[model samples]
Target chain A: MKEMFLIIIFIVASLLGYRVIKEVPSLLHTPLMSGTNAISGVTILGSLVSTAYAVSSGSKFLGFIAVVLATVNLVGGFVVTDRMLKMFKS
Target chain B: MIGTYEIVSIVLSILVLVGIKLMSSPKTAVQGNRIGAMAMLAAVIVVLAYNGIIDVPLLWFAIFVGGVTGYIMAMRVKMIQMPQMVALLNGLGGGASALVALVEIFERYKQMTLFGRLTGQLALAVGAVTFSGSLIAAAKLDRRISQRPIILKNHGLISNAVLLIIILLIITASVANISGIGFIAIITAFLALAYGVLFAIRVGGADMPITISLLNSFSGLAGAICGFTIEDPLLVAVGAIVGASGLILTQIMCGAMNRSLVDILSGSQLNSGINKKET
Candidate 1:
């Protein structure tokens, strides 16, 4: 039941995302890619939860690394996209 | 009845969608990026609170360090290097997803259902592949590696064999005992990494945009699969959205290049006489 729900969510989200992203112009594809790249850091939520529940020190360490990596991807991606968008504005 | 976490996750996902919707125009793109960042911040906070990990100093420290490093890197990177920078960050994101899936497979192995086990292993493979593929793409884009296609003899056969082995490993890991599962997972990751390298190394500079976009999609798909293992609705939805966005970009790139995705993926375009003439 839960898996089915998740699958539906995935399908719906994908359809909506395709529609929304299609509206972006070719000129903005780079920034668009970077923006979506930042969003992919959504994995940070999973990393945090899993790390919190982790039992072994090794797992915790791995989780910590996951957090750091996701953070870098998120922050760096958004900032870079912002910078690029700003260039267009100027 | 819907729980607080469910409500929050749904609302946040909507906000993220709105953020992306705002990105369609250059005038609103900066604001869109800010909104996306803000939504991410809120999601992180909610996860911490919901999981009661809000006070975990180690997590916070890691975030702080990563945040500082990412900011610095973003500020220092030249505009010419944007493609590589995005590729590098995509690699990191995929790497992180692989790590999370790795830890989760071990942490929940004993308690996990068959579905959980399968999804966990799949995520690990996808994430690992995305990580290595994006890194190679980034290196190629940055000119650290030769921009020419590095096709070995019978490259297609080798990649197909590796992919087959990965599928077998995933199936084996799904049913294996906990002790054996760990070893299987490690081997699977190594193979997936190899596959990623093999897959990316054959694409010349001309097809990098498509390669990057495909890898980007893989990263999101990795995260979405990881979400299934953990049963997180927000992660599943947001990751799917990202995956879809990447796929759309890949399609656009393919159209722009006047090549089929299959031609690009199979490396047929690289050696085609038509390609040379067109270029």
Candidate 2:
């Protein structure tokens, strides 16, 4: 079933991510957190869809708000992460 | 047979996973971030282009305004405040997912099957909790709230009681097939929202990074549920990636603090801050 497949992938991905994140140095924790934060902005796609196809004005408004919030999270997260990374590069 | 659109979505999703994996390394992190961002943008564009939705201009305008606001905030915020800002952004992401899920359920309440309804409920509850919990975490990091644990008398009993009530209401609403916007659902939302604040308030500053990471995982899980309700595989894949990564980060953070998840959640270390102060 599709659900079972997703569950399997979830387990595998978690293990892989653990291995990957374990390599990050302590000094870069802040940047790593911020980088992941940007990635979490995947909600923007959902917001956009809801806003564009809303059945009612209330839903439309809610969707609009979602789009804005997700966008802010997306843009801000990336920029902040970049700034933090710059510190280590130098 | 799978169509071109599905093929494209799958490819883009794989790229995103790759980007996240690459990001874990310091040397390729920046490029990995860029790759991830581009994949997200591509996903958005693909969805928008394929779906024949109207009023596209308005959506673009709104995105523009949000981008400007985010750019300004990220630029102005100092490095020391990065953690707080990340918390705020995580909270916003969760809030956005919750709002979209709520809107979807509201518009299609009658058409949803039991599975869809359950997904909706999971997304709603988890999203609301993540939103409020992350905000409280941000406030604590920002020093707007106390960094010490805010434990109430009989805290364990009280919190358990509230959680029990919440689970009961959710089950009742689901079994009874009550509409999402109905009174029971509203009360459940309210309770869940309060639980988020209470949960974060009790976590001390020393354990904040782990708390934030855990909340991030919740938010990502919510997004995955939302994706399932709407049958969006890209969302599911992306959400899973984020959820998995967040969980890993939470574990690493807990290891750093030399504590277990249960120990942190139980508030057993509430007075650890006081002990440090005395030392």
Candidate 3:
């Protein structure tokens, strides 16, 4: 039953994601990526909470890895983005 | 029934619709609005699947964050700065998804059955790559690094060789079920990160929108693979949504730029100079 739940998520999210991406025109790609980037950032906090809640031994280990990866992705991407935005300033 | 990425889809729809109707074209905005609605519906389905019913806490948290962020960015964040903010958020999401996969990887390793290790390793590689690649691409888009392509002359050869070698090592250890497989596998993880950065550095600014989209897809795919490996339904659904969205974005961005995915990947053609040409 739980597995079915996972499979459903797997199928639906991919499909929705596909539609969302497909419908946009190429000219709007920058705005779309930028909007989604912000959206994806919110996932970090959610993942963090999930990681923090992980109690099983295996889950704990994986949780720690998740924290680290999320940190790098968040920090590195933001820093790069900040840098990129600065280009327009000059 | 909602997630950050889904919220973005929704807001993006609003922005496009409002911005376009007010400024551009209603037809285009209508098209975008439909897509946004689809993304929301998709998020809901996964939310239902993973939790059975939307857990109250998750719902409140997601909605509140969405509301607050939406308000703050809309009211306070300038239109010009909106792009950078979006880039930041997307990078964060990709990062978070990758982490979810990592958690699965770490948890599974100690007690991995033979096949478990194979799935686990694949999850890690993909997750690690997404984490690093997305970051680099974000940097390029954000203009933190040079908007110009940062490729080293022989970058393609070096990156490919390294990736292949990492795969070789993973296959050997997982097949042999060797004692030091874990430690060896960790090295490949770092190597993947390095390759991700190098690959993005060479991609020019003009290509960043597409690059970010592709990386976003990678992140989603990583999460899906992780969910599959750990048998986590919610993660798989959410991950799939992200992966699919990323791919679609990549295609759209590619079309707008009038380039093929192949050219974008090669990193030779995508340069910052082109960004100044036109939208």
Candidates in descending DockQ order: 1, 2, 3
Q: In model 1, how large is the Cα lDDT of residue B100? A: 94
Report the lDDT tens digits of candidate 1 across residue range B121-199.
9999999999999999999999999988888999999999999999988887777655777788899999999999999
Question: For residues B1-279, what per-residue lDDT tens digits would candidate 3 score against the true structure?
Answer: 355644543453343223222211223433333343344344444443444444535334444554454444435545555454454455445545555545544444566665556656666677667667767765666678887777786888998987898698668756775666546667867887787787778777777767767877776676666666665444455556556666776776666666777666667564533453333
Off by over 4 Å in 2: A1-20, B270-279
Q: How would you class the docking of model 1?
A: medium
Tell me the spans in candidate 3 whose CA falls farther than 4 Å from its real position: A1-28, A34-90, B1-78, B270-279
Question: Could you list the CA RMSD of all candidates, in the order they appear?
Answer: 2.0, 3.2, 8.0
**Ranking 1 against 2 by TM-score, winner:** 1
Model 2 reproduced share of reference interface contacts: 0.57
Residue A75 of model 2, lDDT score: 89
lDDT of 2 by residue, B1-279 (tens): 346766786787677777777677788878888887888888878878877653488789878988999999999999889888989999988888888778877777577766676677677777888899999999999999998789988887777887888887756655566654545555766777888888998888878888888888887777777877676666776777788878887777666666777767756573553453332
**lDDT scores for all predictions?**
0.88, 0.77, 0.55
Better of 1 and 3 by lDDT: 1
Q: State in Å the error of residue B203, model 2.
A: 0.8
Q: What would you estimate as the lDDT of candidate 1?
A: 0.88
- C-alpha RMSD (angstroms) for model 1: 2.0
Give residue B3's error in model 2 in angstroms.
Answer: 2.7
| TM values, all candidates | 0.96, 0.91, 0.65
